[model samples]
Target: MKGYLKAHTHFFLPSEQMAEYLDLPEKTSYSALPPAGDSNQVLPLPDSALTLFYVGGIGAHYKLNAFIDAARSIPQIRVNLVTRKKQWDEAIASYPTFQSPQIHPYHLNANELDDLYAQSHIGVLAVEPSDYRRFAVPLKLFEYLSRGRPILVTEGTEAARIVSSFNAGWVVPYTAEAIAATLRRLQGNRAEVQAKAANAVSAAKVNTWADRARTVADTLTGKSK
Candidate 1:
């Protein structure tokens, strides 16, 4: 099979791997996880000691409702929803865990959203088999990596393989029981959680977007051909 005419390298590499295990040339890369902050840096997270972020489109297809439901079963797990304003109220109202105080649903602006990534311990991604999700790696995937947080991804797709292969985090089936169980295990073992987080960050340090882009550029420019 050949590459899609309109596809970017990010889409191409993953799709190629998924479809036929094509051996794309490996390239050196790095992540932009923030460096040690100075005195001027102000962390804007709430007072909650443990916060978790779940990002997805506000539409019905993203399956964020399932994530919020799972989060409610876990104690002290602040479920901050990162989404646009138009979909925020509807999402809140439709969410199965609507009234739970532990479920803090916020519609963050771009910068505020980035702050959420910076402050959270785990990053959850909800991507289903829909047109919007196909062949695209959500920014949250890399953002979580860059933040050095352990990621909890719903498995059986490309996202799961990426996390599992890199030793970045846990990949479970898209079920409340599965998600709840994974979070519980992480909560039970703080040392294990921290170790996974460190491993993810270390992996991110090498998988930089700049480097991914350059390799893609080479592939497209005949450097790989």
Candidate 2:
């Protein structure tokens, strides 16, 4: 596989950490190309209170409890937990906080996610830290960026770098204290959220399908090779 990769004209990788796995030479280095988003997404203002949105798994690995724990500190703020109905039911059965009024759970189609994002301020991606996660960028991060919602991701992950690079959102560790502090500090700070959201939207612009295509074309043609 190393020989095959070395012989290739060019190799594109989402993150530089992946380069370590290949151990290729410096000349035939892998290009960094993370995921992109659609520009047609509806952009909306941040909510009055710092509203949070997350769509995906909710089990222990998903770190739903951590988000809930943080949200508990800010009574006014709400956390939108969108996931499978069965998962929600099971979670609700185990965690009493899942039934709290501050936590809103929904099972909606992919298109309906925009409506949810429309009313939210930050998009949460509480992925557990690992070498794979360190390099991998989740698609939902871009989805949040596309809708002008500031991202909320854990540190030591590639997504965190994207958020920092774009000034698109907060990159706190996946801990109750860290998340709560961020929420409490920005609670009801609509202007700050609005400002960062603009950056996120701008960041999304450069990560659109058209932009990705042009980048690939340029790389293939040796313009950036």
Candidate 3:
């Protein structure tokens, strides 16, 4: 049987590596998000909004604290961060900007999350490198990609490869200073950032879950087995 996990390739094992273990003859690449909003219609973006989303664990390894610190440097841009439960209250206490209405953390539904994705400019991935993450990719990365927003990847290991391959976003050092600098750059050049968003959306069209389904079928149907 094949283990197919969509939208987790940012930090996971390369398809070639996984195929080796499964003794499978083929590998499939898929996105976690559905797809870009109908390509026929060009999605308009917020003029002065920069939304950064983080929707996962509350572990110490994920440096959400640092991402908030960096986000504070950009005044013109608004930061909307989403985390699990109430862990952010303490984290927010340390940063005065979180007290401001522009920078927020809250719970959202499926449609609400999609609305956020549609309106967001960047997605902040704050997970650090560990054994589990090294072999596993976060679904959020693919979700962010599906929306065609630039990614601010916090992990400095395998995830970097995907960013580099797609030229999706700026790679910051695993520190507050680097993250701050990258966010500033993104803020200064919103046009360039939007272009990266378009590029990401374009690339995603050719790489999708439907393609993965076909490959999975071929393997299980005894065509590739």
lDDT of 1 by residue, 90-177 (tens): 7667764555876666766656766676667777874444433443456667667766776787766656667787887887777777
TM-score of candidate 1 against the unseen true structure: 0.73
Local error of candidate 2 at 70, Å? Answer: 0.4
Mind giving the per-residue lDDT tens digits that candidate 2 earns over 43-125?
A: 77743566789988877656567768888767888888789998888887898776877888889988877667877988988
- What local lDDT does model 2 show for residue 132? 73
Output the number of the lDDT-best candidate: 2
Give the number of the best model, judged by TM-score.
2
- Model 1 residue runs over 4 Å out of place are 1-14, 17-48, 127-135, 220-225
* TM per prediction: 0.73, 0.89, 0.72
- Poorest 10 consecutive residues of model 2 by lDDT? 42-51
In model 1, what lDDT does residue 167 have?
88
lDDT of 3 by residue, 99-194 (tens): 664466676654567666666777667555555444455666666666676677755444555666788766666676888787777667778888
Output the worst ten-in-a-row residue range by lDDT, candidate 1: 30-39
lDDT agreement of model 3 with the native? 0.59
